[model samples]
Target: MNLKIQKISILLFLFSGLSVFSQIKEEQLILDKKREPEVKKIEKKKTSVESIKNYPPEEKSQNPVEYSITNVPALSDFQTSTLQADDISPNLKTDYYSNYVRFGMGNYGKILGDANVSYTLENKLEVGADAHINANHGLQNIYAWDSRQTSLKAGAFLNGYGEKGKYNVTADFGQENYNYYGIYALNPASDVDINQKVNAFRVKGSYDHFSNEYLNNITFKSSFLSDRFGAKENKGALDFNFSKHDLELPLNDVKMNADLGLGLETQSTDFEILNTNSSSYFLGNLSPKVTFIKDKSYLTIGSGFTYLSTNESNLSLDRKANKTYWFPKAELQLAKSDELKFYAGVDGGLSLNSYASMLEKNLYIVSDQRVTPTETKYNVYLGIRGDVDELIKYDVSIGHSKVNDILFYQTNNLFDTSIAAIRNAYDFANTFSAIYDNGTKNEVNASLQYFPRENFNVSGSFHYINYKMENFDNIYNVPTFSAELGAEYTLLNKKLLLGFKGFMASTMVTNLYDVTNTGLSTNYTTTEQLNTKFGGYVDFNLSAEYKIHKNFSIFAIGNNLIGGNYSTLQGYQVLGAQILGGLKVSF
Candidate 1:
């Protein structure tokens, strides 16, 4: 296939997808309004009355008619609410938080802030904040994916609040600090370090109104997020309904309903490597979704068409022309009783002659390297659960996914020749995930959970992956595993408590019939062998609330009892057992 022909084909498909995006409905401008009278009344009631007081005899006798029922609309059949929360035993809860400050031999140090704090303000709004700072002196895997390299992520996430129908607003901001020794696949043996940071923010507002039918109530939501990883995402949506349950339609012996929504989104990403810089994206999208619901049984179908394009900015390759991409999505669900549920979904999309990495030329890649600019995908899933009523519960699930013309990154030392190759070796040498000329890559995953009580629980999940790489033998199957357990118990008349939790994982690559490109890949696939790595820690915390008198108490806490060494990633070390004890006084 000629390079010119490939470029033209990809351009045509991208343009066609963009045309669909142009038809998306424009967003309606919103005008902020002053708090309404009812909002003011609610605010006043909170501070004016100590509690609900009985109507005085004099006022009750004179305003008897004011309290009549004619002012309020009769409740309808569609009015309902369903609130389900993840259930964890005492052991699981303890382990979940304790895992943050793990303990073990050969561990770097520790990271801080596994717990959180939130505050409530006027107008039904709440503010939340959480922060973590990890600074280890040497190579640690405190937060690294493989626990091999050393790095740090100093960040915080803030949240503000308001509801769809509530007359309120909420927002938050966050930032992360990164200082690492090497980009995962690069000279892991080298001491050269890199520093980076990321910042993000989100805000929302909603208004409420009384309604008689399902279509009268309206709610609008919008949010924007930006990440330093060279990605910026923004999306806004509007949801209007009379009853939240209008989507629940009546079908046979079950209750049923459906909801329809339209939305638009845009995203941009920039990859920064030694010698290459490129941007690939689905800039704008028009999406629509509809859901059908019945008692413990339901199905949902959704689809979106996006105007996608890729921009390659590298000194070595001719700038790839911009092209459009189209992606369609769908999902289905089935559930029988509280203990059993199953679901499946699929998303199909495409990419044009996109850049392979920060350094490489877009014009000189093989059929696999330069996607036809046309692509498709498929996905499926199944799940089951048991014993919802007992203290003990169990769950299992599986999922499979496949994609065509999927983009990938690679690095090659032997292939370097020109200055560009040496400078951008990690970028250009990296191979993209394999794509069959016929178009596709596949993956399978499964997981299980067990809980015997609210205080303790355990779970394990794993995945098996296989891919066909471009220009090389089919890649080997890779298997990954994760397991965790923990518990929490209270003493001192439920005033004092202790909690602990831990987890471990293992990764293996099998059937690697070909090793030619092993070194060209990220993370340097060395040792065509079995690698065994595992770590766990038990965190013991003591918290107490002592009542000095009525309506008041003093609270104190001690953290990280065992000084565990745990690394979330390969080289980032967590902290050693250091304690921060503090007291809070209430009146």
Candidate 2:
């Protein structure tokens, strides 16, 4: 039989139906992630089985079986990756000097000057100093009283690039002087001069770890403020943060992290809320957060527990200012691509307020203004941001807020028969008062930036807000709608730059009190209230700069070209048009 079938090859065709299964265990991926942040991702592909196709039966098979079948096996999942960036280098400009000095002068006896100096030692340490001054003489013919102001600011800083962290320390000082001249029908010849002179000092320090984020940073700040009106303040704050990354959860396979922050603040002031009472405050907060990141999304949840203790001389109008607050800090981010993102969050906290801080906002406020902390119960917001072709970027957001004890600048209600009869500097509607109110606020915000070319760019921002207060009819000095637009064009090899800026705001609300003399001159009283509205104004500005040398440039700025008499507060008018020319020297 072997000799006969040697040449003829008999192929045995056996047909059978069978099914096979295999259990495949997925391999968990471990990524060594460092905090060079920001992410966008998508999920991986799943394993799949290919369906078997039908085949024609063998017509001349001698050993036929029951049936014919095919088997399909799944393919194992795999991923592909590109080269990773593991090294970095310094990208410093060789022909650039960051230190400069500028000086300018304009009409109305205006003067402006600023100087900055910096030095780097051995590529490890840096020291810098800066100073700024702006002053203007009195504008007498335009206003009934003198309108004059002088401001000076100076600062110095030290920085060190340590092996494991970075260190920064800074000290700053400021001096400001201005007159309360926002009065109506006042005689300039009368020697009724009330001045507001303030002096401030601050010291700040920070330390940030480079690689070890567990002890991420520590920051501390202290400030001292005093004024010629016999008010003084001393305040300090300290905070630190720690973080743990790539935490392995109990039973979940996701990227996670934990972060914790602790802060402390204390303030004691002789700033009189009334004429005789002082204020003191202390606050401490502990915050903790956990973050979980999956394929193309991230979620963070946290809370801030704050203990606040305050004593405003226990005024008769209020019992005490002591409370504990809990604020939610939660957010989620979903990314469709590297350039597009959607985010939503709910967060709130406590805002510490002081007389010196109030002066920073409204320089014409009363010296004995009432100051207290603000409590934000919650802020819920949603936003979307994206970039197109690396040339344009846009973001829009909408939010709602619940707030307590918010501050507003309103005109003081005081009466005087003559300038000499004014008892306080803020009398005669010359200065503002620190008014507090509770309310719910809803707002919308949008911004856009376009960088179509290296030499030309444009930017715009818009905001809309509405407040429903509980006790007050209106929120003083707050605009409901605002918008700002700016554009810059650089030609002549980036040496000749032209800039344009414009800002617009909607109507603002304020109130005036009607006064009626009583039976005697001693008891001055009135209860009737009056609501006033000031129409909004629009303003536009332009600037141009030309470089004569690499280290020198001359610039001119034209402000309020629209000349619409823009005023933020009542009875105060800005200059119609102004032009200031300045020179800069870099070395």
Question: Candidate 1 on 1-587: residue-level lDDT in tens?
Answer: 45576456445533543353333211111111111111110111111222111222232121222221111111100100000001111111121111122111122332222223344455434443332333223334332322221212222222222222224354544443334322333332333324333344545554443222344334444444333334333434454443334433445654433333333333333443333343344334454555566666666666655565455454465454554544556666677765556666666654333322211221112112222344565555555544454433455555554555444322222234332232321232322222233323555444444444432333444444555545434322122443433334433333333333333333322221112334445432332222223232333333333433333334333333344444322222344433332232221
Among the numbered candidates, top lDDT falls to 2
Name the best candidate (by TM-score): 2
Which residue pairs of candidate 2 clash?
Answer: none
Estimated TM-score for each candidate: 0.51, 0.79
- Kindly provide the TM-score of model 1 when superposed on the true structure, using C-alpha atoms: 0.51
In order, what lDDT does every prediction score? Answer: 0.34, 0.65
How many backbone overlaps does candidate 1 show? 65
Looking at model 1, which ten-residue stretch has the lowest summed lDDT? 76-85
